[model samples]
Target: MSPVSPLLELDGAVQADGLDAGVAAHYGNPMIEQRRLLAGEAVVDLSNRGVLGVAGPDRLTWLNSISSQELRSLAPGQSAETLLLDPNGRIEYAMDVIDDGVETWLILEAGELPGLHTWLDKMRFTLRVQVVDHSLAYAVIGTMAVDPAAVHLAPAAPNGVALTWRDPWSSVGNGGFQYADAPAHPAADWHWTEALVLRDRLPALRDAVRAGTVSAAGTLALEALRIAAWRPRRATEVDEKTLPHELDWLRSAVHLNKGCYRGQETVAKVHNLGHPPRRLVLLHLDGSDAVLPVHGDEVEATKQLADGETERRGVGVITSSARHHELGPIALAVIKRTVPADITLHVQSQGISVAAAQEVIVPQSAGSVAEIPRLPRLGIRTPGH
Candidate 1:
């Protein structure tokens, strides 16, 4: 059994998921709640999320040298994100990072904590860094579509509150780059913020919610808005073969001009010379009232075989799906880089085929950032030479 959340009593009817997080998959009506969030009239409880703190003098520089982001100059209360990748440039973990002068806090899924802590502990060696899990010490609260100034005003119990983390997703930040070429990126409207407060402060927050002083939305509402924003989550969107470029994560979580790290060479090589093996796409699903597809559902495209018979060919797999208040049914899928750009897709879920229209998130032409010209073979000299 999971430990009860301090706010669980107020939202007991909400469906429960991991880490005893007090979130209903939907609170009776997700559509209504979603509107409340977009209007900045509701808060989402993130107490179930994980928080880790890195302390000591060498924390910033040490983190800069080990991750994809340039964090050595991280200012107090500034927000940034970083990814832990395998030496081969495959994503291993992701964390939303913030600093408060003395400690750098990382927010991620609870399941990622132990592994991250152990890994960081081992990597410390003789560095002046101490990593500590702060799940017991702090909790998180969030709101959507608010600017930085308004984000700082996010509701909080007047107790043990630490600091707020305004998501840097609205625009490209220092050292980061964007691959999504659409003139107007949907993520530009994603004004998400998470506030860190002492664990004991949650009860007071719950009291405020019960007293009608504040409103709350469930995870279902959050998911809908997130999908619409084309945001890639580490828990749902990542797999063993995942690369930052595949999901266009370089726009926020990666730093192109940063110092070398475990996977820097591969990140540089792929972005400058190679194309990602896969591409991330947003699927606007058929709204004929069909069953919604779950994660790992195969996405197929119509292909003509050699015999002149039309066959459904494999194209991709859905990573996350949700029923948006306005968009009805939507999902994020990962498809082959070689898939035809003009092909129409269909998602196969529990044997039910649902038509899917792709809205390019990562284009097939992505990569080659350095733009170095292709030089001729050494033996084939130019006429002038």
Candidate 2:
């Protein structure tokens, strides 16, 4: 279990449960906190998020060779996202990366640090790279503000470059792909960032919140905004078989043209000759029930049988669900790639069926973007012949 954040001692702070345990979920009122967060008037206590440091001259090159993103040319203070995938092209770890001239900082889920650090350490054989877990020394603070300075939190700058990682999900990165096809992507306005601060600064931040000099929101408000922006979080969206294309993660975390890596073959094949087995969708749940569906809840679709009867079949499971300020009860789910986009789905939550309308994110025709022409089959007649 992770250490509980000291901010929980603040008045009205509620400790979050489950994956977000040890951090504040909300500060007594969630709805108002969401508004403040959206207005850039609040900062989220993400002290539980993991922080890792990779120092050495070969940090960028070494990282680029292993991850899905092309990080070899990352300049100091430039933010990028990358994914470490299994040989089968399934996402295993996602990282928010930033180089600070002297070291490369990786921010990820707290529970994922142990595995990622171990894997990175093993891969550093004979390399000039040094992997160090800094989770105990530093804490992460999240905000939707365009700049961290707005929240009065000074990011650590050990190398003269602030250790802040701005999210790259707002646009399709170079050598990346966007499968969502939304002319106006909701992420276009997603100005999210995470700033690493010294762990000892938590008390000062808490005092700032108490003095009302800095407003503090919780993880719940941040989660709601993240869902509305169609951002896929590694903690909730990734499973054993999750592919980057399934979550439309290629828009930011993958470089389709990068050099060979662990999952390069599968990534190339899926993009050029095949399609992802599943696609992500946004679900607008019926808020009338006032029963919000939690993660792992079954998402079912009604099918008309040949016998003229209807049956509810499990199509997918809700990965992350939240009550957005404007969108109301919304969730992100991964359904079959062949599932019809117009179909109405139901979420089985606490024994009650909640009707959900599908908002297509990754379309059924998500992959096979390469325009390779077919060759004539052997022993088959050709028109010219």
Candidate 3:
């Protein structure tokens, strides 16, 4: 047998539906659920996420040598993330990494499992590392804060406590930097967290929800909070050409000073000398209720050329969008860095157009770590000549 499919297993009161093979979109009302979640009073079943186990003495060191983060010193239960990149620095996979003293657990999107696992296996070679898919045996749960009510629902963390990856998206983590310049970045209020749970414990968790003894939220609530906080998700934010800079993900995901791994050269070059070609923006979508742009929707804007004729052109594309319980409709889009900051954007979803206001995340002046003085051209005038 392949494995027992996990879809539609917890639908009694929660009405768990297919967000993925083994996850629910919403328990009941996503708005109420989101409120309960932000208040640290709810849990979200994340069983559909892929969990991979790495064991052996060389696990952390081996992983550090291959991916984007500096993970050799990762302590048990400490959370971190790393990206696997192609030779040209395009993102290939993103790993949400946590370690117990004896093993390392990598959490990732479900659809990425086969590729990630196969690559991990091929890379082992003579190393003492072993990789296994533990998705069938484990699940992931998320909440907004670190409270016992949330903690106890999941299996003990890799360090012999409840296993939780406290999201570092709220601030600049070690060896990383932030380019976004809002005086009070809304992410300052972000406290979202995820934990690993044993698959066996899910039934009890669902039972508690059914009995009204515990509150549970869903992915809808999770996504709304994520966009509002300007956080990045691999499933939505990354494309074949995505670099950390475009999404402002360097705040937590990339370790600038970490020794070379795949893609480090490009990361260093772009971040230090060149501006990323595109920038991420948060859009406060118009409340016309005509349309809500989904992922991949084109963001259009009208621009006037020197001739004074207007052209409606695509300046960006929506990656993720949601209707927040409080914020109404909102989205995160990646726009050309050259797109004028002052112009209003329109999201084209079918025939309806929703007006959007850009809230810049990555500023236009987002590069040049160290200035290199320009050398005077040969035979050209120098200063004071």
State each candidate's clash count.
0, 0, 3
Tens-digit lDDT string for candidate 1 (1-385): 1135666667544865643345455556788889988888777777778889998999999988889898999888788989999999999999998877888999988778889999999999999999998887777778874542242233332323346788787788787778888889988778888887777767777787787666777887888898899999888899999999999999899999877998999999999999989999999999785689978999998888889999988888999888988888999999998887676799999778999888888999888777778797679678899
* TM-score between model 2 and native: 0.97
Give the candidate order by descending TM-score.
Answer: 2, 3, 1
Worst 10 residues of 1 by lDDT: 148-157
The Cα local distance difference test for each model comes to 0.82, 0.92, 0.83
TM-score on alpha carbons, each prediction:
0.92, 0.97, 0.93
Q: Score residue 98 of candidate 3 by CA lDDT.
A: 83
- Superposed Cα deviation of residue 164, candidate 2 (Å): 0.8
> What are the per-residue Cα lDDT tens digits for candidate 3 across 41-62?
8887777788899999999999
Clashing pairs in 3: 157-161, 157-162, 157-163
Residues forming the 10-long window of minimal summed lDDT in candidate 2: 1-10
Which candidate number would show the highest TM-score if scored against the true structure? 2
Clash number for candidate 3: 3
What candidate 2 gets wrong by more than 4 Å, as runs, is 1-3, 375-385
Off by over 4 Å in 1: 18-22, 145-162, 376-385
